[model samples]
Target: MKIYSLINEFSSLDPCVFTLGIFDGVHIGHQKIIKNLILRSRKKYCSVLLTFHPHPKEILNTNKKFFYLNTLSERIYNLKKTGIEHLIVHPFTTNFSKLRTKDFLKKILHPKSKIRKIITGYDSIIGKNRDSSYEELKKISHKYGIKVYKVNPYKFQKKIVSSTHIRESLLLGNIQWANRALGYFYTLSGNVIEGKGIGKMINFPTANLQIDSKKLIPKQGVYAVKINYLNNMYLGMLNIGINPTLEKENRKIKIEVHIFDFFENIYGKKIDILMIRIIREEKKFNSIQELKKQICMDKINIQKFFSCEKKIR
Candidate 1:
C-alpha cells in the first residue's frame, strides 16, 4: 500500500472509496469495515483508508496517557496486510481536533482523498469538538454527492469487539480472550538489547527487548508467547516484571523472553513477541531457588498450552 503522510499527494485523483477510523487493534469490528472497503474499492476501482496518529483522545486530552493497541508502524503494517491500496495517516493535534464536522469532511476527508464513498460505523465521529455523527454524515453526503456506507457494529464472544475492550482485557492480563477479539495474537515489537545478564545468572538466559517506555505493556506477568526472530517462530516464555525476587533496585520493569530449545546471542536483533496466554502473575519468590522452580513450571505450562493449541488447529 502507498502511505501518504499528507493528502496533497493524491489531490489530483478522482474520489476514492475509503473508510476512516482509529482502527486500534484492527480488531474484528475494524476488520469488517476494512473488508467492506476492499470489496467496495474493487467494484469502484479505488481503494483507500484514512486513519490518525496520536489518536484523537491523545490530542484532545494532553493530560491523559495515550494508550493504543498498535504502534504507528504496526498499525500501518497491519493495514497494508489487508490489501489496502492507499493509506492516509494524518497527524492528530489540538488544532486539527478543532475542525468542525463539516470542515473535516470537506477540507480533510473529501478534498484530500476526494473520497467517493465513506464507509464508517454508526458510532464513529470526527471533526472539531467531536461534533460529527452518523446523522450529520448522512446529511453531508446528500449535499456533497458522496456515498456513505455505515457498517453495523460487530460482537465477539457475546460482547462488542472494540479497542477499549481489548485494552481492558490486556490490562487485566487476559490474553486468550483479547486475542479472540483481535483475530490474532497481541504482539509487542521492538529491538533486542543487552541487559545485565541476570537471566544467565539464574540459568534461564533471555533476550531483553528494548521498547518505547510509553508503550502500554500488558499487566505484569509471565506469559506463553511466540517470538519471531528473523523469519522463524519460536515458542517462548516471556516475563514482564520489576524483578522483585532478585531485589533489583533499578525499579525499571524488564521484558525478558526465554526461547525454548534455543541458545544463541540475539542481542541487537529486532523481534516481535506475540502474547498467547498469561501463565501467571508476577510475584516475588522467597529465594533464587524458589524463583527457579517457578520458572520450570512456567515452561512446562507453556509447552502444554502450545501443544494443545497446535492439536486443536
Candidate 2:
C-alpha cells in the first residue's frame, strides 16, 4: 500500500474506488466502510482511503470539540493492516474547510484524485458547517457521474457502534464496552519517565509514562492493563490519576504501570499499555498502610481477571 500526504504529489493515473472521512477511531463502524471499499476494489479499481490530519476542528476552531480515540500515527498504523492499496492523509487547513460541497467534488474528488466511487457512513457529512449530507452527496455524484455508497450501521450486541459511543464509554471507565467496539484493547503509548519513588518503598515498583497531550485519557481509575515493550507483552496494573495518598500538595495527574513478575532498567523506554478492564475508581486512603493493602488486593483481582481469560464476546 502507498501513502500520500500531498494531492499534488500523487501521480497515480488509475481510476480508483475512494472514500473520505475523519475516521477518528477507525472503530467497528469505520471498519465496515473500509471493508466495503476493499471488497469492491478487489474486482476492478485500486482502493483509496482518504483521511484528514490535525482534525478539522483544530483548523476551524469550532465550539464543538472532541477527544480522539487514536492519534494520526495510530490511525495510519491501523489502516496499514487493513490491506488497502492506497492511503492519502490530506492535511486539514482553514482554507480547505471553507470549500463548499460542489467545489470540493469538482476540484478535489473528481479531477485531482479521479474518484470513481465514494463510500461513507450513513450519517456522514462534509463541506463547511457540515452542510453536505448523504442526499447532498448523491445529488452531487450524479453531476460528476460518480457512484456513492453509504455503509450501514455496525453494531456490537444490539447497540449501534460509533466513535462517539466509544469515547463516552471510555470517559466513563467502561473499557470493556469501548474495547468491544474497537475490536481491540484501548491503548496508550509513551516513554517511561522518572517519578517519585513512592511505589518502590511500598514493594511495588512502577514505570511512569508521559502520554500525548492530544490523546484522550481514560477515566481516572485503576485498571487491569497489558504492557508491550521490547517485543514482549506483560500483564500489568495501571493507575491513572493523581497520587492522592502520596501527594497532598501540587498534585499532578500521571499514569503509572506496575508490571508483574518483571524487573529491568526501563526508564526512557517507550511502552504501550492496553487497558483491559477497570478494577476500581481512584480514591484516597487515610493512611499509607491502607493504600498499600488496597494495592495488594488489586494485584490479586488483576490476576483473576487474566486467569479467567475473559475475551470480548
Candidate 3:
C-alpha cells in the first residue's frame, strides 16, 4: 500500500472510496468496515484509508491520559494487511480539530479530489465537537456528489466488538476474552532492558522490557505468553507487577518475561509478547523461597496449558 503524509499528496485522479478513523487495534468492527470498503472499491474506485497521527485525543485532551492499543507503527502494520490501496496519515493539530463538518468534507470530497464514496462505522462522528452524525455527513457530501455508507456494528457473543471493550478486558486481566474480541492475541512490543537479577537467583532469569509509555498495559499479573524475538517464537511466562517479595518499598510496575528452554544475551533486543492467559495476580510472598515455589507451580501450569493447546490444535 502507498502511504501519504497529507491528503493533498494523494494526487490520484481516479475516483476513490475512502474511510477515515484512528482504527486503534484494528479490531473486528474496524475490519468489517474495511471489508465493505474494499468490496465497494473493487470496480472503479481505489480504496483509501485516512487516519491521524499522534492521535487526536492526545492534542485535544491535554489533561486526560489516554492509552492506545497499538502504536502508530503497529497501526500502520495492521492496516496494511487489509489490502487498502492508499493510506493518508494526516497531521492532527488543534487547528485541524476546529474544522466544521462541511469544511472537512470539502477538503476531501471536493470535485478535484474525486472521492466517489465514503464508508464509515455506524457510530462515527467528526468535525468540531464531533457533532456530525451520519445523516449530517450524507447531507453535506451530497453537495459534492459523494455517497456515504455506514457499516452496521459488528458483534461477538451478542456484544459489540470495540477497542474500548478490548481495553477494558485487558485491564481486568481477561486475556482470553480480549483475544476473542481482538481476533488475535494481544501483543506488547518493547526492548529488553537490564534488571535487578532477582529472577536469576531463583533460576528463572527474565528479560525486562521497556515498553512505550503510550501503549496500554494489561492488568498486573503473571501470564502465559508467547515471545517473538528476531522473527522466532518461544513459549514463555510474563509478569507485570512490582516485586513485592523482593522489595519492601519499591512500587513501580515491572514487565519481565521468562522464556522457557532458552538462554541468550538479549539485553538490548526488541521482542513482542503475545499474552495468552492470566496465571495469577501479583502477591507478596513472605520469602524468596516461597515466591520461587509459587513460580515453579505457575510454570508447570503454563507448560500443561500449552501442551493441551497443541493437542487441541
Candidate 4:
C-alpha cells in the first residue's frame, strides 16, 4: 500500500473509491467498509483508505482522554493486511478541524483523492462538531458526481462491532468479546528491553517489553497470550502491572512475558504479544513461593485455554 502523509507529502489526485475515519481498532465494522472499498475498486476506480493522526479528539481538545485500540503504526500495519491500494493519513489539527463539512468535502475529501465513491458506515461523520450526516453526505456527493455507499453496522456476539466497545471490553478484561469484535486478538508489540532479572531468580524468566505509551493497555492482570518472535509463534503468559508482590521503589506498570519452553537471548528484539484472555488480576502475594505457585496455575490455565480453543476450531 502507498502511504501518503498529508502533513508532509503532496496529496494524490488519483480517482478512487475512498473511506475516511480514525479507525481506531479497525474492528469488524471498520473492516466491512474496507472490504467493500476493495471490492468496489475496478480498472477505473482504485481503493483509498484515508485516516487522520493525533485523532480528532486531541485536535478538538476534548475533555476525554484519547485511548485508541491501535497506535498509528499498528493501524497502518492492520490496514496493509487488508490489501488496500492506497492510504492517506491526514494530520488532524485545530486548523484542520476548522474546515466545515462542505469545506472538508470540497478541499480535502474530493480534490485530493478525487473519490468516485465513498464507503463508510451510516453513522460515520467527520469535521467540526461531528457535523456531517449520511443525508448531507449524499447531497454533496451528488453535486460532486460521486456515489455514496453506507455500510450497515457489522454485528458480532449480538452487538454492533465497534472500536469503543472493543476498548471497553479490553479494559474490563473481557478478552473474548473484544477479540470477537476485533476479528483478531488485540496485541501489544514492541521491543524487549532489559529488566531486573527477578523472574529469572524465580525460575520464570521473562522478557521485559517496552510498548508504545500511547497504545491503550488492557486492564492490569495476568493473561494468556500468543507471542510472535522472529516468525515463531509461542504460547505464553504475561503479566501487565507493577509486581505488587515485590517491594520496588518505582511501582510503575510493566509488561513481562514468559514464553513456555522457549529460552533465548531476546533482549533488544521486537516481538508481538497477542492477548488471548485474562487469567487473573494482579495481586500482592505474601511470599515468593506463593507468587511462583500462582504463576504455575496461570500456566496450566493458559494451556487449557489453548487446548479448548483448538478443539473449537
- Measured by TM-score, the strongest candidate is 3
Point to the candidate with the largest lDDT.
Answer: 3
- Against the true structure, what is each candidate's TM-score? 0.94, 0.93, 0.96, 0.93
Across residues 1-313, which tens digit of lDDT does each residue of candidate 3 receive? Answer: 9999997898777888989988889998998999999999998899999988777778889998889999989999999999999999999899998888767877776667778889998776567846545666788688778888989988888889888899899999998888988878999999999999887889999999999999999999999999999999999999999988897788888999999999898999999999999999999999899999999999999999999999999
What do the candidate models score in CA lDDT, each in turn? 0.83, 0.85, 0.90, 0.85
Could you give candidate 2's per-residue lDDT for residues 1-313 as a string of tens digits? 7999975566558878888888888888888999999987786888988788878766676776656789888999888888888888988888887887666665555545577788888776667646555666788776678888888899897889988789899999999999989988899999999998888899899999999887889999999999999889999999999988888885778999999999897999999999998999999999999999999999999998898885632
Q: Is candidate 2 or candidate 3 better by lDDT?
A: 3
Q: Tens-digit lDDT track for model 4 on 93-193?
A: 88888877766766644534477888877567687646445666778888778898889999886888888788889889999899989989999999999
lDDT of 3: 0.90
As for TM-score, the candidate ahead, 1 or 4, is 1
Off by over 4 Å in 1: 108-114, 129-132
Encode model 1's per-residue lDDT on 76-151: one tens digit a residue.
8888889888888988887878777777766644433467788886566677645446667778776767788988
| Superposed model 4: Cα runs more than 4 Å off | 7-14, 62-64, 109-113, 129-132
In candidate 2, which residue pairs clash? none
- Where does the lowest 10-residue lDDT sum fall in candidate 2? 104-113
